[model samples]
Every structure is written in structure tokens, then in C-alpha cells.
Target: MFMLKQQKAKIIDEVTKSLSNAQLILLTDYKGMNVENITKLRDDLRKVDAEYKVMKNTLLKISLTNVGLSIDDLSGSLEGTTAILYTDKDPVMALKVLYNFIEENGNIPVVKSGFFERKFIDQAQAKEFSALPPKEVLLAQLVGQIQAPIYSLHAVLSGMLRKLVYVLDGIKDKKPN
Candidate 1:
């Protein structure tokens, strides 16, 4: 009994550490998902530097408390076969993988709720998050936006220079040789 308690405490500590480091935390109902599917999901998450873990609700609650999060905020999310998807890196990538996996697997696991950027998000919000383009794409778009004016300015300056050169050549040609 004492050993069991010690193990549980260790597990709680590990979970607490994970919770603290995670930038995005999603609670999912992974009921009815087979071992193979769960393994595949874990591999997919791993590729994005995220993790998928099936943890006991009690231990999870304890970990949440340790991380200074109120369980009440999560309310009803801890029930059932809860699996946690957490990532310290790009949250949107992780969410995309999970959503894509769900689509391919007949929606075996459903997202119950999520905690991202220090706020709670529902299923619809999670889907919205997944719909966002990847970080690289967003960054590229921003760079293009920032450079658009510069490109336009260059074009205008070059056009004026070309016109001036043409007028100078015309004047030179008209002058008596």
C-alpha cells in the first residue's frame, strides 16, 4: 500500500511537470479507440513535439491543482476515458494532426475541451484552431505583407528613372550632331 502511494505521488509529480511546460492542453475522450489507433496517434503527436497520454482523472486533477489551475474551469472534462494532448511547440500543428487522425479514424476520439493561451476552449474552438494554417505559412504571409509596400516603392522609382533616361536620349537625338 505504501509503495502504491509512492508511485502515485511520483506519477502526479511527472504529470505536474508536463502540465507546467505545456503551451496547449487538450482533453479528449479516447473511448473506443483501439491500441493500434492510439499508438498511431501518439506517433503523430510525437512528430509535432506533442504528447498524447491516457491518465487517470484523479491524478490529472491533482496535477492540475499542482499547476495552479482550478479543476472547476475544466468541469466535466475529466470524466470518461480522458486523454491529454499537450505540446510546448506549435499548438496548431498538434491540433491539426489530432483532427486529421479523427477524420481518418471515423472520429473515434472526440475533443472535449482545451486550455490554450491561458484560456478554456470548447470543441468548436478546437476545430477552429486546427483550421488555422501552419506557423511557417502564417510567417510567410506576414513577410509578404511587410514587403509589399517596399516592392511597390521600388517599382515606382524604377519606372520614373526609365522615363527620365528615355527623355534624355530623345533630347540628345534631337540636338544637332
Candidate 2:
């Protein structure tokens, strides 16, 4: 019992450190998952540079308090078997990745709540948001959209210049003839 308590304390400290630097923290319930499934989930998360771990809800609450975070809403989410995910990268992308994995796997736990960009997202909102495209793809699409006008202007100007050059050549040839 003492060893388990110490271990829980260490896990809380580790989670606290992760939360300190992480831009997002997601809590989920993994009650039905087995070791193999959990390992697979962890590996998938690692590919995208996120960390997943299990910890006692009480210790997690202590960590949140220690960090001066307001976790009142998170209290309800603390019930039931839980796992936490943290990432220093864009929190949205992390949520997106995990939620997508859950969607595909079809047998894991469900997301309960998320802390992202200083806002709390409920399970439904988290699922909806995570289904969207990743950050890079969204940024690339935005850049392309922003540059469309410039690209079109350049094309139009080039076409006009080509026509002008063709007219000038025609005039020159006729004059010499």
C-alpha cells in the first residue's frame, strides 16, 4: 500500500511537470482497454509527440491545484477509470489525433473533457473538433487561399504582356514588308 501510494505520488508529479509545459491536457476513460490495446494507443500517440499516462484522480487534482489551475469543472470528469494525455504542441492537433484514433479503434474509452487554449471542451465538442484536419494541412490551405489573388494577378499580367508582344511583332513585320 505504501509503495502504491509513493508510485501514485510520482505519477502525479510527472503529470504535473507535463502539464506545466503542455499546451493541452486531455482526460479520458479507459476502463475497458487491455494492456496490448493501451500499448498500441500509447505508440500511436508517441508518433505524434504526445504523452499518455494513468494516474489517481486525487493526485491529479492536487497537481492541478498546485499549478493554480481552476479545475472545478474537471471534478465531474474525475469519476470512472481515466487516462490523461499531454502535448507541448498544438493542443487541438493532439485532441484531433486521439479522438480520431478512438473513432477508428472503436473499442477504447471515450474522451470526458479537455483543457485547451485556456478553455474547457466537453466530450461532444472535443470529438467534433478532433475530426477536423490537422494544423499543417489547415495552415497550408489558409496560405493557398491567401495567395490566390496574387497568383491570379500574376497570371493575368503575364497573359496581357504576351498579347502585347504578339501585337508589337505583328506591327513590326508588316512595316518592314
Candidate 3:
């Protein structure tokens, strides 16, 4: 049983370190997925700098309690082949990847709830996360919004310059130059 304890301790340490900088914690049940499918999922999450880890319920509880995180609301879902996804950056991209996986695979394992920024959100809220654009897209949108007024001001000033150009052209024609 010494080996068992050592495994648990390792898991606890891993969970603690992984969640320390994580902004989003997603819990999913990857029950029916085969090795290939799970590997694909892991690869997709890795692209977004997220990790997928399967843990024992007891160890998960111990780790969360140790790390000062509360999963009380999601405790019910910590059952039956649960795999946790921890993301320090771009939670939306990771969520979208899982959402798409579920969609493409006919929703077999099921997405439970998630811990986002210290708040426990239900599946509906998790769906909202999937609807969000990726970090790059959101940033680009914000930049576009911020630059719109400047572009409009430039266009207005250019219209006045065009009017002056027209006036000068008319004067030149009248002077026969």
C-alpha cells in the first residue's frame, strides 16, 4: 500500500502545481473515448496550453482542499472517469475545442461544470464560454472597435482636402494656365 500512497501524493502535488496558475478548471467524463480519441483531445488542448488529467475523486478532493479551491457544487460530477482540464491561458479556446469534440462525437462522455476564475459555473455557462471567440479574435475585435473612430475622423478630413483640390482645379481652369 506504500506505492498507492506515493501515487496519491504525486497526484496531489501535480494538481496543486497545475491549478496554481490556472484560470479555468474544466471537468469532463471521458468514459467511452478510446485511446486514439483521447490522444486527439490531448493534442488539441495542448495547442491551447491546456492539460487534461484524470484523477481519483479522493485525491482530487484532498488536492482542492489543500489548494484552497472549492468544488462543492461540482462534487456531484466528480464521478465515473472524470478528466480535468486546467488552462492558464485562453480558456475560451480550450472550451471551444472540447465543445466541438462533444459535438462531433455525439456527446458521449458529457461535460459537467467548470471552475472559472473562482466561480463554479453550470453546463449552460460553460456553453456560453464555447460561444466566445478565441483570444486572438477577441483582441482583434477590440482593436478594430478602438480604431474605428480614428478611421472616421481621417475620412472626414480627407473629404475637406478633396473639396479644396476641386476648388484649386476650377481656379486653374479659369486662369487658362
TM-scores, each model vs. reference: 0.87, 0.78, 0.79
lDDT of 3 by residue, 21-42 (tens): 7888888888898888888888
Q: Model 1 reaches what TM-score against the true structure?
A: 0.87
> Which ranking of candidates, highest lDDT first?
1, 3, 2
**Model 1: colliding residue pairs:** none
Best by TM-score: 1
Ranking by TM-score: 1, 3, 2
Could you tell which candidate, 1 or 2, scores higher by TM-score? 1
Backbone clash numbers for all candidates listed: 0, 0, 0
Q: List runs of model 1 lying over 4 Å from the truth.
A: 1-3
lDDT of 1 by residue, 39-144 (tens): 9999999999999999888888899889877778688898989999998899999999999999999997999997886578889999999999998999999999
Candidate 2 Cα misplacement greater than 4 A, ranges: 1-9, 90-93, 104-107, 162-177
